[model samples]
Target: MQDPLPQIVDSHCHLDFDDLAADLPDVVARATAAGVTRMVTICTRLRNAAHVRAIAETHGPVFWAAGTHPMSVADEPMATLDELEKLARHPKFVGIGETGLDYHYTAETKALQQDSLRLHIEAARRTGLPLIIHARDADDDMARILTEEYRAGPYSCVMHCFSSSAELARAALDLGFYLSMSGIAAFPKSAELRAIFAAAPLERILLETDSPYLAPPPHRGKRNEPAYTAHTARVGAEVFGLDYADFAAATSTNFDRLFWKAAAWAKAA
Candidate 1:
C-alpha cells in the first residue's frame, strides 16, 4: 500500500554551503530517493545570495531564502535596513532571514545583533515574506524583540533549529510563529526537548536537517544532508507517538504553508 503520509520537506538547510555545493546534484538525487522531495536553502550572507537562488531555480522541488545572517551582517555589505529590504524582494527569495539574535559565541555584541535582526524584521514586514530566525543562548532577547516588533507590523517568524527555553517556545507559539526542529531533538539526552515536542501543536511544527551539521543519532557527527531529514522526521514521530506517515505529512504541510508557492508540490499526484 502506498504510504498515506506525504514526502518530507527540509524546511531549512545550507545546501548552498561549500560542502553540499561540491556535490549538489548527487545530494538532491539521494534526498529525493529518501522521500525528502523538497528543501529550502537558507542564505547566510548577501554575497552568496545568488548561489542560494541558483540552487532553488535549478531544482524544481527546491525553494530559497535571502537576507544576511545576524552574525554575518556585521561584516557584510548590505549592513543597513534599506539594503536588506532591497535584496529580500527577489521573486525566488521567499523568506527574509537566518537573521535573529545569537549570543552563543560572545564575540558579537548584543546591540549590534539586535540592530541587524530589527532590520530584517522590517524587511519581512515590507516584503511580506516569512522571517527565518536563528536564536541561540539569547531566547529571552529573541522573544522580547519578536514581541516588541509585533506591535510595529504584521510579520511572520520562525525559530529555526529551535533549542531554547520552554518560556521562549511558549511565547513564539502564542505569537503564531512556527518552531522548526532539527536533528538535535534526536540526541540521546534531549528528553526535555522531546517533552516540548509532545505539547507543540502538530500544525505549528516544522522539520529540517540544517545540513552539514546536526546529523541525527545514527548519522551523528557525520556530514549531514537533506536526505537525512528522514531521521529527524522519524524521531519527531516517536516523540508524539504519531504514526510516521502522519507526522511526515503534517510537517510537509507546515513547510508548504510557510514557504513560497511551488507548482511541483501543488501539482503532485
Candidate 2:
C-alpha cells in the first residue's frame, strides 16, 4: 500500500460558492483522500454567513470565517463591529475575515475598503482570532493600514493567498503576521512569488488552495477545491527544500497556531 500522505489544512477556501457546494460530499471526500484533513471556508459577504456557517456545521472537518470582501465593500451593506463580533461567537468561526483592500478591481472603493478592514481588525482583536487579509494591488495602503492599526493594538493575522510585493511581505512579517501560500505560488510562472515564500521563515508559512479558484499547475485554469491543496503543499515543500511530510507538518502547525479555535474544536471532538 502507498504510504499515507502528510496531513494538512486548506487555510482558506469558499466552499459555499456554487461550484463546490453543488457536490459537497464528493468534494470533501476527495480532499480527505488527498490528505487535506481540515478546511476553513471563508464567507465573503456577511449576508451569506448563514449558508457558510451551515456548511461548516454539517461537515466534520470544515470551519469558517465571515467578512465583507473589499471588492464588495461598495456594493454590500457595510459591516459593523458589533455584527462581526457576534459572528465571532460561533463555535466554528475560526477567523475574522478574508478582508482587506483589493484596489485592482475596486480602487474607487478604497476608502470604504479601508474602513471595513479596520473594523474587521478590531473584531479580530476582540475575539482573539486571526485576521484573514486579501490584498491585491494595494500593497502600500495595505501595509500602511495594517501597521497603523497594529500599533493601535496588536492582533494576529494571516495574509491569505499572498501574491504581493516583497516589501509587503516584510512588513507583514515584521508585525509577526503569517503569509499563506496559495495555488498561485505553485504555477510555472510564479518563480519570483515562490522565492518570496522561500525567503520567509518556514514556521510562518501556511498552505491553502483558495478554491474554487487559482488551482495549481497541472490543474491550472480548472476549478479548484480543497483536494488541490496537496498540489500546492508539494510545491511548498520544494520551495522550503524539505521533504513533503515535513513541510506538511510545519504548515499544519502554523495553521493551528493562527486558527487556534479550530485546533480547540478538533481536540474537543
Candidate 3:
C-alpha cells in the first residue's frame, strides 16, 4: 500500500516555465492528485516574476519566489536590489532566490555568479524573505559568499537541490540555513549524500523536485513534475530510516518555520 501523503510539500518547483505553463491546470490537478499539497514555483529571472505571480494569484496551493537565477542574472546585470525588493514585497512572493554559483553549465566566471548572488542576498535581507540558493561545482565559493552575506543580513535560506560536500552542508547549517534534498539524492552513487542525510537534523531539511529537471530514480532520464516529489520523499524516508508520515511532517514543518513570514498567507488560502 502507498503510504498516506500526510503533509507533503514541494518547497521548490518551476511551474511557470513554459513547458509546464500550457498545462498549468492539469499540472496542478496532477500535483493535488498525488497528494502534493503545496508548491513554490521558482522565479528564475526577474522578468518572469509577473508570470510567477500570475500563477500564484490564479492557483490554490501554489506560491512564488522573486529573484533571478545566477546563470540568468548576468543577462540582466542591471537587475537592482530596489527592483527585487519591489517584487519581493508582494504577498504572493515567499522567497528571494534560486540564485548562486554554477560552474558546471556555462563558461560564466565566478565573479559574475558572486555578483548575482550578492544581489539576491541583499533582497532577502531587505524583505526578510527566505533565499533559495543553487550551487554546483562551486560549493566552496558559494559557502564563503553566504558566510560573508549572512554577516551583513542574517537572512534565512535553503541550499536548494543540495548535492555538495559535507563541508558545504556544514557551512550552510552553521549559518542557520536549511538544506533541500532533490530527486538527485536518490541516485545509486549518492551514497555519501545519503550518509549526510542520515546525520542531518530533520528540522533543517527540506524536500523538493526541482521538477522538469532532476527526476528521481524509477523515473530518471525523463521530464519531472511536482507529483514525483512523493517518490523522492520515499527515497529520503528510506535513506533516513524514518516513517513516511513522520518524514513528510518534519519537512513541511521545516519549510513552515524557515519561511514563517509567509506562513499566514499560505494558511489563509
Candidate 4:
C-alpha cells in the first residue's frame, strides 16, 4: 500500500476571490487530496469580510483573517481598530491582516496606508492574534513602523508571502516574527529569496500559496490554489535541506504556533 502524503498547511490564500470561489468545493478537495489539510483565507477588504468568513465557516479545514490591503487603502474605507477587534471575535478568525505598506503601486496613498497599517497593528495587539503583513517597496517605512510598534507593545506577526530584502527579513526575524514562504520562493529566479529563507531559522518558517496568484513552476502562469502549497513546500524542503515530510511537519508546526486560534480550534475539534 502507498504511504499517506505528509500533512501541510496553506497559511495564506483567498478562497472568496472569484477565481477560486467559482469552484470552491473542488479547489478545497484538491488541496485536501494533496495533503494540504488546513488553509487561511484572507479578506483584503473589510466589505468582503462576510464572504471570506463564510468560506471558512463552510469549509472544515479553512480559517480566516481580515484587513484592508495597503494597495486598496485608497478605494476601501479605512479599517478601524474597533472593526478589526470585532472581527477577531469570530470563532475561526485567526489573524489581523494581509495588511502593511505596499508603496510599490500605491505610493501615492502612503500616508493613509501608514495610518491604516498602524490601526491594524493596534487591533492585533489588543486581540492577541498574529499580524499578517503584506509589505512591498516600502521596506524602510515597513521596518520602521513595525519596530516602532513592537517597542510600544509586542505582538506576534507573520510576514505573509514574504519576498522582500534580506534587511527587512532580518528586521522581522529580529522582532521574533515568522516569515511565510509562498509560490514566489519556488520560482527559478528566486534563488536569492530562497537563500534568505535558508539563512533564517527553520523554526521561524511557514508555507503558503497566496493563491489565485503566483502559482509555482509547472503551475506557473496559471491560477493558484491551496493544493499548490505542496509545490512551494517541496521547494522549501530543498531550500532547507530536509526531506519533504520533515519540511511539511516543521512548517505546519510553525503555522500552529503563529496561528494559535487555529491550533486551538483544531484541538477542540
Candidate 5:
C-alpha cells in the first residue's frame, strides 16, 4: 500500500558522509516510509564527487549537487567552473554548492572561500542550476556578495539550512531566492529563526534535513537522516499556520521549482 502520509522532499542532506552512508539503504527506506519521496545529497568536496554521484545513480530517490564547502575551501583544490558544469551533465545532478561563507570557524580562509563561492556562482549561472548556500556568521558579506553577484547576472539559489538574521533573510528573499527550513528551525530556542521563516512568503520556503547534523526535537542531539525532514516540515507548517499536507505540498512544489532537473528526471523515470 502507498504511504498515507504527505509527500516530502529533503532538499539538502549529506548521505555521502560516514554517519548515514554506513547504512544508507535503511536510511533511504526510512525516509521513503516517512513520505520522503526525494532527497538531494550534497557533495561538499569535489574529490568525493564520484562517490556522491554514484549514490544518486544507485538510489532511485536520490539526486545530488557538488562543490567545495567553504570550511574545506582551504584544504581542497578550489572548484572550477568547468568541473562543476561537467558534473551537472549527469541527469540527477540538480544543484550547485553546499557552499558559501563559514566565518564562524573558517574565518582565516575567507578570501579563498569567497573566490570559491564566486566560481560556484558562475557554475550555477552557466548550468542554470540552483546554488545551494551555507552561510554562517558572515551575513554582511553573504548579503553583499549575493546581491552583487545577482546584479551581475541573475541566477537561481536557495539559502540551505538558513538560520541567519532577518536582514540576510530579507536580502535573499528580495533577490527571489528560496530559504530552506532545516531541523534547526524546529529547535525550542529557535523562535527567532522561526519568525524569520514566518515573515517570508510560503512559496519561497523549502525543507531540508542537512542531516547527519541538525536533527529536530525528540531526535535532537542524535544523528539525523532524511526521514526526519517530516519533523521539520511539521514545524514549518505550524510557523506558516498551514496544515501538514498543505505545507508538505507547498514545499514539494517549491523543491520542484528550485530543483527542476530532479523534477524532470522523476517525470522521465
Candidate 6:
C-alpha cells in the first residue's frame, strides 16, 4: 500500500468567499484527502465576519480570523480594536488579520490602511493571537509599521502569501515573524521569491493556498483551495532541499507554534 501523505495545515484561505463556499463540503473534503488537516478562513471585511465565523463554526477542521483588507480600507468602515478583540474571543478564531498595507492598486488608501493595520496589531497584542499579514507593494512601510508596533509591544505574526522583497523577508524574520509559502512560491519563474524563503529558517515558515486564487502549477490559473497547500509544500520541500515529509513536519510544527490557539484547540480535542 502507498504510504499516507504527510499532514500539513493550510494556514490561510477564504472559505466564506462564494466560489469555495458554494461547495464548502467538497472543498473541505478535497483538502482533507490531500492531507491538509486544518485551515484558517480569513474575513477581509468586518461586515462579513458573521458569515466567515459561521463557516468555521460549522466546519470541524476550519478556524478563522478577521480584519479589513487594505484595498477596501478607503470605502469600508475602519475596524475597531474592540470589535476585533470581540471576534478574537470566539473559540474558532485563531488569528488577527489578513491585514496590512497593499499599495499596488490602492496606494490612495495608504494612511487609512496603516491606521487599520495598527488597530489590528493592537487587537493581536491584547488577545495574544497571531497577526496574518497581506503585504504587497508597500513592503517598506509594511516593514516599518510592523517594526514600530512590535517595538511598542511584541506580538506574533505571519507574512501571509509572501511574495515580497528579500529585504522585507529579513525584516520580518528579524522580528521573529513567520513567512508563509503560498502558490506564488511554486510558480516556475519565482526563483527569486523561493530563494527568499530558502534563506529564512524553516522553523519560521507556514504554508497556505490563499485560495480561490494563486493556485500552484498543474492547478495554475485555476481556483485554489486548501488541498493546493500540499502542492506549495512540495515546492517548499524542494526549496529547502528536504524530503516532503520532513518539510511538512517542520511547517506543521511552525504553524502550531505561531498559531498557538489552534494548537491548544487540537490538544483539547
RMSD of each: 2.2, 0.8, 1.8, 0.7, 1.1, 0.8
**Prediction-by-prediction clash tally:** 0, 0, 0, 0, 0, 0
Overall local distance difference test of candidate 1: 0.82
Q: What is the lDDT of candidate 2?
A: 0.95
Estimate the TM-score for candidate 4: 0.99
Cα lDDT computed for each candidate against the true fold: 0.82, 0.95, 0.85, 0.96, 0.96, 0.94
List pairs with backbone clashes in candidate 1. none
Per-residue accuracy of model 1 over 1-269 as CA lDDT, tens digit each: 97543588888889888888899999999889889887888888878877788888898667788766766656776556676667665555668888888788744667888888888898888777788999888987888899999877878888899889899999899988999989999999998988887788988899999998999989999999999999999999998788888899888888777774432334562
Question: What tens digits encode model 3's per-residue C-alpha lDDT throughout 67-132?
Answer: 667777567754688888888778778888888888888546668778878878888888888889
Candidate 4: worst-modelled 10 consecutive residues by lDDT? 77-86
The TM-score measured for candidate 3 stands at 0.95
Q: By the TM-score metric, which is better: model 1 or model 4?
A: 4
Q: Per-residue CA lDDT of candidate 4, range 1-269, in tens?
A: 99889999999999998999999999999999999999999999999999899999999999999999999999998888889989999999999998999987889999999999999999999999999999999999999999999999999999999999999999999999999999999999999999999999999999999999999998999999999999999999999999999999999999999999999999999
What's the true lDDT of residue 135 in model 2?
Answer: 98
What is model 1's C-alpha RMSD? Answer: 2.2
> What does candidate 6's lDDT look like per residue over 30-127, in tens digits?
99999999999999999999999999989999999998988899889988888998898999899998799989999988999999899999999999
- Per-residue lDDT of candidate 5, residues 1-269 (tens digit): 95579999999999989999899999999999999999999999999999999999999999999998999988899888889989999999999998999999989999999998999999999999999999999999999999999999999999999999999999999999999999999999999999999999999999999999999998999999999999999999999999999999999999999999999999898
| lDDT against true structure, model 5 | 0.96
What count of clashes does model 2 give?
Answer: 0
Q: For candidate 3, give the lDDT.
A: 0.85
Evaluated against the true structure, the overall lDDT of model 6 is 0.94
State TM-scores per candidate. 0.93, 0.99, 0.95, 0.99, 0.98, 0.98
In the range 181-246, model 2's lDDT, one tens digit per residue, is: 999999899999999998999989999999999999889999999999999999999999999999
| Model 5 bad stretches (over 4 Å) | 1-3
